[model samples]
Target: MAKDELGYDRIVERQLRGVAREVLLQVGSKGLPGDHHFYITFRTDYPGVSIGPTLKAQFPKEITIVLQHQFWGLEVTDEAFAVTLSFSGKHERLHVPFDALVSFTDPSVKFGLQFELKNQQVELQPADKPAPGAAKDEAPTALPKKSETKPAETNGGGDAKPATIIALDNFRKKH
Candidate 1:
């Protein structure tokens, strides 16, 4: 077996993360063009992640956020991005680094990207670190209290939730 270059994997990882960041910035700044929304999953414990106490508590390891009609105040930097999203009617800001992202999916187009952590980077922590000023077992306190009134019913049914359908296609055939 041939030995690969030591830094090649790191370089590739960096570039992939950059692509994720760029795509996020574009969608965030311009809004979803046409019928496009993203389901982004990231490691809550990654460095530079700043989330509310309630969110941390609910999603202690990982969380997937939807970028649909309710997110606001998106700002993207070279290394990370910050945005405010409403959860249970309470608005909370989140700061997530590109390195923390594990998956990015556009359900409208059924397009997605999944990443594998490069084990070579031993200095970085896994996706279970507590945010600054947070205790080891601190639960997120930002989640809104449950409302008494039920949400409006759609024409589909009486308050039942809609299902998400995803289609997978394989262009190559193996025998």
Candidate 2:
């Protein structure tokens, strides 16, 4: 097996994360365009993940958040993004670092990215608390399969297209 002294895999992963970040930055500035929504899955326990204690207790491992409607405070940075989403009528803020993301899916367009999260290193931040007496809405879902965008999930169109999931494992060193 040849040694990847240049760390090509890591480089590719960083670039992919950058792509996700760019998409998010645009959405933050202008909101989701058309029926294009997002299913962002991230590690709940990862460093820099700031969510209310209730949410942490519920989704200890990970969670998938829908970013179509009923969300606010869409802030994006080079490292991470923050937003408030509704989970069963309870509104909670979440701060997820890009390195903690497992996948990003926009089933409407059948475009998805399955990240190879090798670099979990992120700046630690304080846990976020729910707004005083603020009730949540609905969005948080159990971390579904890495790339399961079923035909029924795609928004109204002539025919649903199979999701294209880009996974880096296919290009990684076998050894």
Candidate 3:
């Protein structure tokens, strides 16, 4: 492989993200077929994310939401998506930008898509106790440092790995 000069655009990555978002849009517009459901993990503090104060306080860092049943108003746009989910018996709308997404998985068919957040790296860790008065509402924080970010693995025996994930990585030419 030839050396890639500086300022090289990662068009393939962008297209992959687009394809993932398009799939979600289709699921939203239509509906999940058979036992198919989504396990969407995203950065709670991303710029375009909007959750209730309680939810933000609970999941101050990153959160995973399931889209199988008990969801409504799933609207998908070019940049972000919004849906109403029941939390603690209350319906709350969540706005998550596609860039903020970390991973999307459907365990039924073992399908998955992982995305890299722009200018941000997210490292997953155990949740800590909330600080004093941390429950107060606040704006989304800046993207976490790259050092803290880690890619999720789809390892479970040998058959659990999604073929799409491997195929996409192979198609990308590393620089």
The top-ranked prediction according to lDDT is: 2
Instruction: Show where candidate 2 strays beyond 4 Å.
Output: 119-137, 145-160
| Cα lDDT of model 1 by residue, 70-161, tens digit | 77898889888898877655678999978787656665554555555544222212335333354222222221111331222332344444
Give the clashing residue pairs of candidate 3, or none: 122-149, 123-148, 123-149
Q: Which candidate is the best by TM-score?
A: 2
Ranking by lDDT: 2, 3, 1
TM-score of 3: 0.72
Model 3 lDDT, residue 23, Cα: 75
Misplaced by over 4 Å in model 3 are 1-9, 128-175
- What TM-score would each prediction reach against the true structure? 0.65, 0.81, 0.72
Worst 10 residues of 1 by lDDT: 164-173
Q: How many collisions per candidate?
A: 6, 6, 3
Clashes of 1: 6
The lDDT values for all models are 0.61, 0.75, 0.68
Mind giving the per-residue lDDT tens digits that candidate 3 earns over 91-121? 7899998888876766666666666668986
Give me the overall lDDT of model 3: 0.68
Which stretch of 10 consecutive residues in model 2 shows the poorest summed lDDT? 122-131
Instruction: Compare candidates 1 and 2 on TM-score and give the better one.
Output: 2
